[model samples]
Target chain A: MLYLIGLGLGDEKDVTLKGLEVIRSCARVYLEAYTSILTVRKETLEEFYGRELILADRETVEQEADEILRDAAVSDVALLVVGDPFGATTHSDLVLRAAKAGIQHHVIHNASIMTAVGCCGLQLYNFGETVSIVFWTDMWKPESFYDKIRRNRLSGMHTLCLLDIKVKEQSIENLMKGKKVFEPPRYMTVNQAVDQLLEIVQNRRELGEELALTENTICVGLARVGASDQKISAGTLQQLSSVDFGGPLHSLAISGCMHPLELDMLKLFAVEPSTFEQINIEDSSTYLS
Target chain B: MLYLIGLGLGDEKDVTLKGLEVIRSCARVYLEAYTSILTVRKETLEEFYGRELILADRETVEQEADEILRDAAVSDVALLVVGDPFGATTHSDLVLRAAKAGIQHHVIHNASIMTAVGCCGLQLYNFGETVSIVFWTDMWKPESFYDKIRRNRLSGMHTLCLLDIKVKEQSIENLMKGKKVFEPPRYMTVNQAVDQLLEIVQNRRELGEELALTENTICVGLARVGASDQKISAGTLQQLSSVDFGGPLHSLAISGCMHPLELDMLKLFAVEPSTFEQINIEDSSTYLS
Candidate 1:
């Protein structure tokens, strides 16, 4: 049997009791680390679970999945992933491989960031669509994600912007040069992502595209979610771009039409809610303020 | 100081080590119950954490804010949320209240469903906008969310559909009649949400509005996410509509355009990879088959 477990977000202790039990019973445990990272380290998890965990990077999972699935053919193998097993499409492939081989598998679920965005005091029901913002490279600055966020906001839905994280990713030059060079791990901070978003907004503005994203747009920044010392701050997009959230692993939310209550809650997190009123007078004074 | 901690999507053990340390040190620990529920009960968590926990319902948190915040004003009080502290926005109000009352507070993070959807083999970066699918009532079946999903799908961005959960809510008739009757808890399952989505799709089809959703469109169903018994099944929106994922808590993903690699991963989860053959077909098919 192949046991696919969700480690929940954060550290080793975040694994479900049932998942931990499965891990303990499994002959081999592999932690798929590329898709997401927990706030805790591998050593901390190993100490608590009392099992040696092999760190499975993107290459291990994507390029060498056969080895991970090799033992499952004979014995119970557990592949632990942060968040729900199906939260990332990567594990779905593992499930598929297990299915193709006719190996019975079980999935252990856990909280992922998708449903957890509600903690920012926005109504879960009111959110429109979530989008991801990637690191803008000099050669590849794709604004496609921006288009989606723009549409979501136009329809009055809150947009949760997932920041990018590059783990063990090779630079294009390295691949072309065949140098096997790897860049340092980079987790997009909420501040940096906001800066890129602002740049895109400016680009669109120059092109006369009537985009909703602006410097003073209400935005929420979250850092080190599911870890101790998680930080959440609400401010204008401009404020967020400058405000240091102080950590790796960050996310940003550009709220759409908010409820009166949501606006009130966001007010406390604002760096300059007073100045923000100029851009959103009706929402600021008429509804929430 | 008040520490709002997310327990994540699973049982008691899902709490991070950081969160646990805080819980052990805090004077009061309250679990927010209305927004979401953990697979393990309070007793289960108490047994694991070796600390008693107070389950705070919406009433306790919202109505009795004064009481919950009283101790926080003086010392450390930990408010535990099921997912990430900001996952549900419910805590934002609490956080705001604490801020206004001159109470210092901190947030402990946990993996939330927001970022966890990446596990489903979907490209986290490919997702366009996240939308919420609410439990439809006989009187209040709003289809606005459909528009948002349609918009996202049109733009070839995956949509993360957050299912609804209603707890401690009053019956409409009972409330209107001034009776103290309560309704049973209602968690929007994957099947029911899909059924409604299909109905809305059919409605749009009749109205001559080109809908991005169709019966054969690819969708990923998630249930009991972040829990030990989590299940993920990939199929057409039609096939998914008939699947009874079982138990409380469910989410759905309507995939849009896929990158070559993403399409490859998604095929691994599909009911029939051949039916999914159209997925970036130009890419090498030899390895996929």
Candidate 2:
């Protein structure tokens, strides 16, 4: 039997009771570390679980999944994932492989940013398709997510922008030379994402396309969500681009049509309470009644 | 401090260690019962947590919210919600009210069907806006969800349809007379949802509109997700409508354009192995190589 457990977004204590029980029963445990991350350190998790964890990087999981599944047919083996097991497509692929191999598998679901983004005061049902914003390299900048955000905005739905985290990445030059040296881990900040989004808006302007977002567009930046020190600030794109959210694992949300109550709730987290009134184009007073 | 904790899908054991700790520390705990429910009985949860839970129905939550929020400013209060705390907009409204009352609050996130639907072998990122399918009444049947599904399909994204569950609902006659009588709990099954969807497609056909889905369209039906007896079946709409996915809390998903890998994974759960080849319009043979 194989258990794919989710270590929910916070510290080690965020694991569900069922997940903890399964982890304790497992003969061997592997932590998939490359996709998303928990707020606590690996050592903290190890201490809490009272078991040693084998770190499964991208290469280890992608190339050596068979080894992890070898003994699962007879004994319980657990692979812990940061968020939900299926938050990333690779995990789904792993489950499929386990199924094909005739191994009994179970998934213990936990919270991921997909649902936790609701903490920003926007209703979960009102959110449209979510998009991921990757770190822009000089030559590999992509703006496809811009149109997706536009579509969501046009439909009067908020959009959740998942920030990129580059871990164990190799430079293009090193890949060509077959070098194993890896770059330092980099997590995209809300400021960096905002800058790239602004650049895309500028390019679209040059191309004579109507802008989906502007400098005064309402945006919310959340950092270290589910943690005690988690910070959420709502402001315009221009204001958010200069705001420091502190630390890694940040997310951004572009507001669409806002209900007056939603506007009232979000205003409490605004950079400046008056900024909402100054820049919000929506007639929020209509919903006050 | 007020703690809004999510009880992930399934039984009491699905609650996170952090959520459990908070519940234990709270002086008073209220379980929000009207929005959604767990597979286990309230007694099961009370036994597991060793805490007596105050059942907060829709009327209690909506009309008597102040009672729930009272004393939170000086005492620890926990409002337990099935799934994520913000899965429903009313929770957000509650949070806003808490803020207005100057109460310190925290949200403990948990797994929701929004993300757990990935257990069906579909990538979460590929899912577009989610729609809710309510039990149709003789006088009021809404087909707006059909348009939403069509939009998602046109965008090449899957659509997760959240089936409605009516608990502690008052009948129209009783409500008109201000009676205190309540109706029996009713949960919309996948079969019922598919029937309504097919009826909508038939109506569209009569209106000379091109169909976005048909009886042969691939669909997946899931019941008691995240529970031990959780069941998932992938088949054509017609086939799924006849399949019995036992118990309550069912959900449906309409397939959009499928990646070959996704199709492969979904085929493993197909009602009939040949059904995939017969109903899948996409050329999946190319993916076999």
- Index of the highest-lDDT prediction: 2
Each model's DockQ? Answer: 0.34, 0.72
Best by the DockQ measure? 2
Q: Would you give me the overall lDDT of model 1?
A: 0.75
Query: What would the TM-scores of all predictions be?
Result: 0.78, 0.96
CAPRI band for model 1:
acceptable
Error of 1 at B123 (Å): 4.9
lDDT digits (tens) for residues A36-145 of candidate 1? 77787888889999989999888888788788888787898888887667653346666667777878777665666665556666666566556778888888999987
lDDT accuracy of residue B186 in candidate 2: 91
Clashes in model 2: which pairs? none
lDDT by candidate, in order shown = 0.75, 0.85
B1-289: candidate 2 lDDT, tens digit per residue: 8899999998889999999999988999999987787999889999999999999988888888899999999999999999889764347677778888999889998888888888787778788888999899999999999999998887778899999989888899999999989999998999999999989989999999977777777889999889999999998788888999988889998888777777887887899889777543443321221
Q: Which candidate is the best by TM-score?
A: 2
